[model samples]
Target: MRLPRQREAEVTPLHADAVRALIDAAAPRFRALYLLAASSGLRQGELFGLEVDCVDFLRREVTVRQQLIAPDDGEPYLGEPKTHESYRTVPLTKAVVDALAAHLEQFPADGVKIEDRTDPRKLHHRTARLLFLNQRREVGRRGAWSQVWGRSRRIANKALAATYDKAHAAWVRNGRTEGREPARVEVPDGASLHGMRHFYASLLIKHRENVKTVQKRLGHAKPSITLDTYTHLWPDEEDTTRAAVEAVLGDVPPLCPAKSA
Candidate 1:
């Protein structure tokens, strides 16, 4: 369904199983990347720019540090966030913590190395010493270690597209039809990596988490932005809230009363 431009959008929640399937299909690097984005509401650049140092397991927080910036050639560079709001800390979940831990084990602190079979030196010369590097390494060699903002964005976009395609195909194979026609595929309407952030926000609200808490988690410039965007997700709980409010407003009229005989 198309949303009105004037209306702020609420994040739509995906089924738990579907969410898991999506994450699983993105396996290896992309899977971990997907979890971080969905759970933390991190922008693509912010996620790609994360370093090992950014994770604070003891504190259960991930600090906002550098992000990937404009890339020259196939490499990406490190850069500061565009705005102050974009630079904010994120609280993590056990799933996120576990995903990160597993990612570290697979990738390690040493990083993915780049190699040039023809001229190893040339490959080393191109690699940028950024958080997300080419998943290949050239031993005893160093590259330029520039920034990788653009490259990271490209990678994320491609990965997201691939996921949608896979999901679409799976839907078709299951004999799901769109409308009255036998559907060839079922693609989500305008689903993007950012949609995952919306999913995260809605999840928090569903759990009765405070708007301010969601605001901080999403690093919005103001709490209003969080409230405006997600208020629709919550129903008017006036009847339920009345009892609680009456405790403080003792002078208030009774929310419900017995009928007169």
Candidate 2:
């Protein structure tokens, strides 16, 4: 049966500066969480599920074996990763590693009771040192975490807007008439915790990372999924083609000699 094609939604990743602002504006308790989100391409659930043992400090990597699943009617529990590909070891940048180290020092890991649902046949209870916890020192619930993210986003947006206003005022006072006025910067309302994941993807793309590498980092099952989401972020083939041809032919002499003019 034929159906109307829906328009692909545009993905506007958080700008690098905005990401910094967001992290800066986030509560001290969650600063590392936001930084990790932007640095590692882990999903919210994976971040929620992280345990002290998941991180390998010497290796500079985090193992993704499980995720925190929050059900509507019941409590959050530990479950298998979304897919097999999701169970990967994601490398960490030095900056992220330092941030994590500082965070651990500031907020010591607490042993929390985790309900394990990884084995569907039987549920198990275990105490593990979770990486992040709410104010009550409990495993963070998705809803509460999202609310905190929303508050941080609003605070960051206001700070950005104020900075833009101050710059615009200065420009007007200086009577600068050179180029078009810079566009005002504001983190979009649509930006959410997931936007940090998109920001991470953009970072990989900016560094000219290959499709397969980006796919692996993001834990996508296939390269096609990565390309489908971020194809536009890649450099245009036309530009590369032109540059290649120019490099080869730019200094060559004309084949035919011209007559005296």
Residues 101-196, model 2: lDDT tens digits: 998998889688989987789889998687888888898776787799888989998988888887788778778674567567667876888899
The Cα error of candidate 2 at residue 36, in Å, is 0.4
lDDT of 1: 0.63
lDDT tens string, model 1, 1-261? Answer: 987778544556654444455566563655777788778888766776677788887776787765655344443445666567777888898878888888777766564333222232443322333344344532211233212222333454555666667767766777866433322222144555676677788888888889888887887889888887888886566576767777889786667977799
CA deviation > 4 Å runs, candidate 2 = 177-180, 239-261
* Best prediction by lDDT: 2
Report the error of model 2 at residue 103, Å. Answer: 1.1
RMSD of each: 10.6, 4.7
Best by TM-score: 2
TM-score of 1: 0.61
Error of 2 at 141 (Å): 1.9
